[model samples]
Each structure stands twice: as structure tokens, then as C-alpha cells.
Target chain A: MSVPNAQRQIDMLTKMLRIREFEERVKRTFTDHPGVIRGHTHLADGAEASIVGSLSHFKKGDAALATYRCHGYPIALGTDTKAMMAEILGRVDGLCKGLGGSMHLTDVKKGFLGTSGIVGAGIPHAAGAAWAAQIRKKREVVFCFFGDGASKQGAFAETLNIASLWKLPVIFVMENNGYNVVTTSAQEDANAAAGQPLSIKAKSFAMPGVTVDGTDPLAVAAAVGKAVRRARRGDGPTLVESKVYRLSAHGNIIAPPGVPLHYPEHEAITVFGKREEYEAALRGDPVPRFRGILVQNGTLTAAAADAITQKVVAEMEAAVKFAVASPYPKLESALDHVYA
Target chain B: MAQLPYIAAIDAGIHQEMRRDPSVLYFGQNLATTENHEFVAAYGHDRVRVTPISETAEIGMAIGAAMAGFRPVVELYMAEFMLVAMDQVLNEAPKFRYMSGGQVKVPLVLKAGFGFACGWAGQHTGSLTALFMGVPGLKVVVPSTAADAKGLMATSIRDDNPVVFMHHYLLTLEHGEVPDGEHLVPFGQAAIRRTGGDVTLVATGWMVNRALAAAEALAKEGIQAEVIDPRTVAPLDLDTILKSVAKTGRLVVVDQAPRHATVGGIIAADVVEHGFESLRAPIIQVNARDTTVPYSEPLEAYVIPDEARICAAVRKVCKTAR
Candidate 1:
């Protein structure tokens, strides 16, 4: 597999920073602009390296589907962040016209097909898109992203079995963040209890499985690039377990109307009382670590890195301003688009 | 026109679309297994293949494929099998278009047999037309006649939305004269099987035949009962039913599902609300008794609606009006 060039590496850093900055504004929206985002919104604060690196192999014809922690994928795919923010803010200018909001951010034109609020649900959808690509006689592949918790779902097993059997061109990316909504992986996952990597589940479906450090962009890119090649070659699917840390809680606290919503403490601290573990994750945060690597290797000057940071910050700030100023969709529009 | 059984006509409808549109796909469990399989031989392996008995994946993949610009028809033998993947059926397939704000269209069909009261017992024998009709993005089709079976299937495949094409198992081998080519039945149009001015009888799927038989029996008693079959329930033809009620001044609705779960109740509520003044007597509904469809033959016969019960309900409505 070809390594991303120095310029490409710097581009990856820029996308990673964009994701981090975009989501940081989303988290702050709960407090900075109270009640702008409604319902449960999961942030991809720590999975930037994983999200950006895996998508680095994406091409024009390729498609990707993800779970509810979905803001980062569309941002990395170059969807207008202003519309994404408008969607989160429930404005008419939103990506889905405020119908789907943060949990269901979809940009079909960019090949980020859709997102599923249900876990393990979007896996077969990617395989379905892969089937379409297969019929088109194109080497297009689909990237299926889900969390470690989704592996236990029946959809996961059933989809993997069929995907492998049909030799469909799709890559399964499981972001192993070690938590499934307040429960650690060991408490629920059999492989985790046995001290085996979650990637081992791919063996049951007769496909190659690999585990990589998700915080390292190059590591994730190299691993996912190999799988993309396998899929494009029509050899079948490969499961890549990119192990990362969920630096935030599962989502903002779910509250009834009139109660202010905001992000809670990391489950490692709130539920398990492991402050140091949470602190350690923050220290090894992927965004700065990748930036440090680029600076150390002379791919980016420290001055250039600061400039990129300032640019992303301003872009996201403008997105927030545009979103908060936008108007809500007309009440009658709720009846539209229900049939076709 | 050619004489065709309901099951064959459904296949003919699929063949019609597969011949016309290259993007139409047909796949499910226990189908197209070998080289000589009809669909495989006809469309090749790329568009037709057998899948494992994984309902969630089978339906889920169809949704993905539909969104990606292929029209897929999933052959689920029994309606209850959809319960195994209701999330994909009810939640995923129907919600994608609206959720995407018209960005994508899921043009697919879920073909399943329902109301199989021929000793299939509780699980397999369910009239689930009402369950899907209420869902916004889904179009529910219940074709009673062989001709309608072919026509409605064609319309469903061509429509740019998710459709649940429910064919009654009891009517699978029933034969009728189906048009030879490209016969398309529009959704939301009710078929008036018999026209009369004394009393109106409304039904769907297997119950349409039962209602027709009851209409014949009612004619001997000097009760001219008008019979209407709503080919599609989602876009229900309330206007025709209301117009029939206006002429007849009496009504009886027959459904094979339990009383509480019948589409008859929904129609009754609509007629009463919209056409209440036209009603000369309280409407009567001949629905199955509320219980798990029993395994015993006698119990099954007693629990579901039959021609005798439909006739009795029609007579009661006619008598009550006078």
C-alpha cells in the first residue's frame, strides 16, 4: 500500500483538526447557546484520527455509513459545516432540512450515504451499497463504521456472514473505544473478557482481522488502506478494529423539555471513578499528537500548524453564527417528504 | 388475456419489471440456489441470488441497495418473518427517504404472504395490513384477484417508495383472467366487485372473496349489497367507500384480523367522521374473534371471518336500517 505523501499527511492533519474543532463547538452549543441542539448528540472528540485516517482511502465512488456518533464523517467528507451546524441547531438550512438533526447527518452527494441511530444497523447498508458498486463493475468500496458495542448485535454477525460469502466490496471499521454507554467492554463482550481483541470476531466470518492504534493517523491509514485494496480487488471484506479512547461521555444527558442539556463527565470518571484513565486519554489526545508528529518530521512548521488551527477555529465560529441566526423550518414542512 | 393463478401472476409481474428495468433485483432465502433457478437463469447471478436465513441482513441489505439506486424485492415467505427485522422494515426502510430530506429514495418491495389460515396457526396466519398501512412512507398492497395480484405488483415495483406487497396465501392458487402485458393497477383505488343500492360491504385480501360470496347470498334475500375491495390500504379510497355508503345507506366491513387490529375499524372511524350523515344505521364490522389463531381446524374456522358471518353482518346492517 502506498503511504500518504507529506502534503497528504498535512491534509489529514487539517481534516482531523477540523473535526475536533467542529465537535468542540457542538459540545459548547449546549452551554454557549443553551438548548440549540436538541435530543441526544454523541461527539467524536477522540476518534478524529480514526475517522479521518480510515476515510483517507475514500474515493469518488466510495460510500461510508456510520452510527450515531456521526458529525465527524460528513465533516471529513467535505460537507458544508455551516449546514451541518444548522441541522444540529434545528434550522431550515440544515443538511437534512432540520428533519434529522445531529444524529442523522447525511450528505448523499459526498458519498456519506446515511447514519443510523441504532447500533450495528448501518453495517448491511454499506454492504448493500457495495453490492450496487459490484453490479456497476466499478472497484468502488463502502466503509462501514460502528462501535465496539455493535459487535454483539445479531445484525453484525448476519451482515458479516453474508458480506464475506458474497465477497462484497466493503470494509468494516469498528472503533473500539472500550465503552458501550457506561459499561466497559469486559463486562459485556466475551472476547474482551477472554483478553482477546474484538477483531478476532472476524475469524468466525472467515476474513482477515487487524487491530491498530486509532490515535495514530498513519497507523489507521496504513491498516485501512490494505483493507480497501482487498475490497477493491474483489477478494471480499476485511474487519479493522481501530482502538481509540472516547474522550467524552456517550452523549449529552437526555432530559425532558425545560431542563438544560449539556455533556456530562467521561464515564471513566463518573461511572468507574477512574479519573487518571480519563486524564491519560486527554494527555494522549489524537489531534495534538498528530500535529506534534507532523511538526517533528518537518512536514508542517509549528507556525503553519497554528495557522491551520486559527483557520479551523474561525470557520467553525462562522458556522455556529450562521446556524444560530438561521430560522426554524416551517411547521407545515413536517408533512413534506413522508411519501417520496 | 390469460388465465393465471395468483402466485404465478405475481411472478409474472416481477418478470415484467425485470425485463423492463435493469436495476430491479430479486433475492431471498431458498430461492435462486442453482444454475437452473428461473430468476438466476433469467437475470444472471448479479441481480438474483439466495441469501441466508438472516431476516435482518436480508431486509437491511435491500434498504442499502435501494438507496444506492437498485430496486430490490425481498421474498419473505411469511409476513411474520418481517417481525424478526421490524427495525429494518418499519424503522429503516421507510424512514430513510424522509429522514434524508428527499436526498435519497428507497425503491424496493417486500413480498410476503399473509393470512395463511390453512393450518399455519397463530404466527404465520396474521392479517398485518393494518400494521403497515398506518406507517407514512410505506405503501401496503393486498391484492385479492389474480389480475390485481399482477397489476398491483407491477405498480409497486415502479413506485419510488418502499411497498409491502402482501398476497393472501389462501388465494395463492386461485385463478383469474389477468391481462397479457404491462397491466398496472394504481394504488388507493378501490375495486367495486358488486354494485347495489341497498347495503355496502367493504373488504380486502382474502376477505374480498368472502364478501363477494356473502354479496351473492344477500341477493337471494332481496338485499342488494355493494362490495368494494380497497386494493391498497395506505392510500385507502375513502371517497369510494363514502360514495357507496351514500347510495346504500347501510354498511358492513369484513376483515380477517382480530377486531381491534382490523383495517375495518379504521375505515369505520373515517366513514363515521366524514360521512356520518349518510349512515342510516350503525355500521357493523365482521372481524375475526380476538384470540391467537388456534391450531385445531374447527377452532380456526370459528375464530376467523367466513362467508356465513359476513352474510349475517350484512343482513343485520340491512335490517337495522329499516
Candidate 2:
């Protein structure tokens, strides 16, 4: 439960940089290689520190499930970015054989079980996996990720109650990005409107609730690491409200086939006209903020950070090339996998 | 073989799988509340425990457990309870294997009872077989006998897909000879309850008994009817119905659900499209009246398909000529 050492800190920063770079490529795909990616694509540029830190404690036997803002978890879990990109581009070599697009990226082999496009639906699914882990008696845990909006869903309440009652080994990580699509948390969430942290809702279920600065990887790691240990010890589930800001709009503008799709400006500026708030979030963007902290603390040198950045940029660049060059799946293969 | 009630046969099927596969889990609302409960006694609490009245979590947990390499049978008790968690039942459980491109198999069973028309009233007495039968990735099983109940439940557990095993509430205590052990009835096969030449009677679940009684009445009237019970509706045995139609040259479909929601309508459409030449008469469908089943006994009886309705439909089909 102690702070991650220098090596682990550098590793966490590397992962955050990879996620930021991968999300940038996905955003650029709208213009750089128009029409290559289809459907709604959510970006995880701002939540990288929280994602990487929580998953840093992941082990071989553990499992993780997340919302559609899913690209970051797999990257931290060591999934092949090439296959992930191919999946987003609907290619034969895709992670899910092109059947599941960006929203449903899954790598069971890597213990990244799957993602649910619907808000709050995947929460109970994580508890279900935790039940399996409990039955296995291996002290393994499950990490369940969703947004602050998902906390309003009935699945969240039902699952939290049952998870605590059964003492299921799962962590409910709510990334409070301040918005559920275009609606702000204060508009939709009772706790937020009352000026209470969303984590306070967990008290009703009789489990520990903690709020952390999601923009800091070390903070998230420390908080989530304690919960992981408690879960491993069969204590019960915990609810961690990791507060972060989404760097992009909820997703690319949804449109018909004839009209082109693209990512719009963040709702802070576009919908709420709060340019100053958006500017503040941009200045505190976790990816660069973590890098600056590492340099100031002497855990990482400028040259080392730059080298890591160059490698991740080249890695993602190759992923885009490979994905664009990959061929579409066979038309008839659509009929496959309808039944197992 | 041994004589067992429909409910016990279903339990036998579950016990059959749970005994062999330690990974098979049976849990639901209010079933295993005590340690001495039958399932918890046999399999222990790790594999059997009582869940809260959270349908969404119950089915969703089953899907997650299934993905993690365990076969879970969620004891839903009533099919209408599934409506409370349609997203998990319709979207999540069935879509995982397909959306994951076969990378994960959701091998689980949703055991729910349907068609309890004995004064249970509208909300509790619906025959919702057709609602689940048409979902692409779901397998819907409607067993009409104790033997088929044990066998189909076994097969549903073994099948590597999401299965909705809809057992009729009226048949909970109906006794029949079930196989002693390892009884597994394959899906997508029809059971010919009776064979005749004048008309073919196609039905499922409780309607099969009504169709059989109607066939007997039709036999006495010199209009022989062949009764066909399609055990599993999703992987429907259309070929058997077509072949039966070819021999009888007349078709009569009886369903306990409303007219539009009847699986018979789907089967009738398939027959008309695929076996039009085999029919000497227009297919007659005898479905329940399109209304909520009333609480009154007579009104409920009038709303549901009965032996008289099936016999009337069969006789009507037999009267038509090529």
C-alpha cells in the first residue's frame, strides 16, 4: 500500500504516455485517414493517470471490466495496440476479429475481460467476475471502471449492495470527469448537486469510500493499492471516486453514413461556454503533469522521458499504418460467432 | 426411468450437472437462504447461495461468471422477472460471444417458469416464449414433459451459448417417467406426440397437451391429426413440421401466447415460404385472444388456447381441399 518506487513511477508514466499517444492517433484518424474508423469512439486522454495507476496493481489471475472509454485499460494491461487499432478500423486482424468495434474492445487473455457501451451495465458484470475469483479461492480481485454518470444507474446501486453483502472482491472506480456526455454531474447527480463527493454514496452500502486526485498516478496507485490489498484479504469491495477531467468531447459527432463524423470540442467550451474551466483542465492535463513531476523529483530525466515519448509515438504510428493497411473481414464471416 | 414431477425433474437435471462439474453454479432469489437448502447442501455455499431480488445483477453476474469459465444457471423462478433485467438478458448475455467474435463463450441458463394460467392473473400468467425465441444469439427451450424438462435443462447447461429455459408453471407437479441419470435431450428437435394423416397439429409447452387432447377428439371425428411439439423454439425443428405437413397436407398451429407473439406465427410463415407446395389447405393458427389474462377463472380460460380451440382449428384445416 506504499507509494510506487521510481521504476514503477516511470513505468506508470510510460503507460500514461502510450494511452495519450494512442488516443491522439484515434482522434487524428478522423482527419488523417478519413472514414477509417466508424461508429462512436470515446477518447481516454485525460484519465490516463487514473487508469494506469489502478491497473498497475493488476496481476495475472485478476480481471478488469470498463465502460466504452476503454482504450486506456488494455494499453496499460499490455494488449497489442496493433490489434486494437485494427479492431477500431474493422479489420480481419482486429482484436475481436472486427466484430466488436472500438467500443467493445476485449482481451480475455490479458485479463481485460470486456467493456459495456451502456452506462452502469458492466458494474454487475465485474461483481460476477469477482464471484468467480472468490470461488477460485486465489485472493484475486476485479477492477470495475465506469464514469460518474454510471453511478446514477440502478445497476450501480444493486451491484454495490450485493457486492458488499457477499463481500465480493471488486473495486468500483468511478472516474468523475464532471460530465455525462453533454450533461454536467451537478445537473444529473444528487450528491454532486448537494456539493458532496460521489464517493459518499458508497457509505449507504456499508463499504469504505475514498476520493483521490485522479490527475496524479501515484495518488491513485496508493489509494487503489490499499483497496486491492483489502480485497485480496477478503475484506470486501471498495468504491474509489477518482476525479479527473475528460480532455475531449464525449465522443465523435454521431452522423449518418453519407455525412462525415468527427470529434467536437469538449462540452465545457462548446455546451457550457466555460472556456476558462476547460483551459484550466488543459493546463493540468495528467500526461504532461505526471512527466513534469517525474523530472522535478529526479525519478526520470528529461532525455529519458523524451525517449519514451518518441518510442510510444512511433509505436502508435506503426499501429495506424498496420490498421489502415489491414483488409476488411470477409463478408460471409459476419455469420460466424453468432452462437458459441 | 423413474416417475417424477416436472419441478423435481428440472432439479434432477441441475443436480446432474452440478455433481459432475464443480464449476456449475446455481443461485437466485430466495432459494438457498438456509445452509440445509437442497442445492447448498449438495454443492456448498461457494457454488450455491441466495442472491437478492436484483434481476439485473443476478443475470449479469451469471454472464460474467460464464465468461470466466463457469456454467451458471440463474434460478429466475418466473419469466416476467427477466423483464426487470432485459438488458442483461437480451443485450449483455447473448451479445458477448458474438460481439467478442467467439473469443468468449457465455455458457449459462436462465431457468424461468411461464404460462401459469390457473388464476395467477395477467402479470404472472403470460406465455412469453416467443419474446425470447427470436433473439439471434439466444436459445429458447420450452419443454412439455418431465423427461424433456430434465433432458433439455441438461443440454442447455452443456450448450456453449445463452439459453432461456422456459418451464411452464402449470406443469410444475405433473408426473412422468424421467430417465434415472444423464438425461440430455438435444435441441432443435420436435417430439411427435401423435401421428395421423388428415391434419398436422403444431404446439409447444402446455399447448402440446391441449393439442394432443384435440388430436384425440379429431381422431374420433375421423379427422386424424398429427401433433408436433417443438422442444426448442429458437433452434426450431422446422423440417419436422414441413415433413408432417407434407404427409398430412393440412396444418394447424396452437399457441398459448397472443396471436402476434405466438411462435406459431413464425413457424406458419416459414411453412408458407418453404413448404407451400406441401400444403393442401391454408395454415390455421389457434392463438390466445389478444388481451391480458384476466384474474377470473372463466375469463382466463377464454383468453388462453384450449382443447376446444385446437380441435376446432384442426377440423377447419381438415375441411379444406386442394
Error of 1 at B185 (Å): 0.8
Docking class of 1: high
lDDT of 1: 0.94
lDDT of each: 0.94, 0.93
Residues B1-322 of candidate 2 have per-residue lDDT tens digits of 9999999999999999999999899999998988789898899999997899999999999988988889999999999999999999998998988778788899999999999999998798998999998898999999999999999999999999999999999999999999997889999999999999888999999989989988888788888889999999989999999999999888989999999999999999999999999999999899999999999989998889999888877777767767
Candidate 1, residue A219: Cα displacement in angstroms equals 0.7
Model 1, stretches more than 4 Å misplaced?
none
Provide the DockQ value for model 2. Answer: 0.82
For the second chain, the TM-scores of the candidates in order are: 0.99, 0.99
Model 1 per-residue lDDT tens digits across residues B1-322: 9999999999999999999999999999999999999999999999998999999999999989998999999999999999999999899998888888789899999999999997988899999889998899999999999999999999999999999999999999999999998899999999999999998899999999999988888899898889999999988999999999999888899999999898999999999999999999999999999999998999999999999998888777777885
Give candidate 1's error at residue A116 in angstroms: 1.0
TM-score of 2: 0.99
- Residue B297's C-alpha lDDT in candidate 1? 98
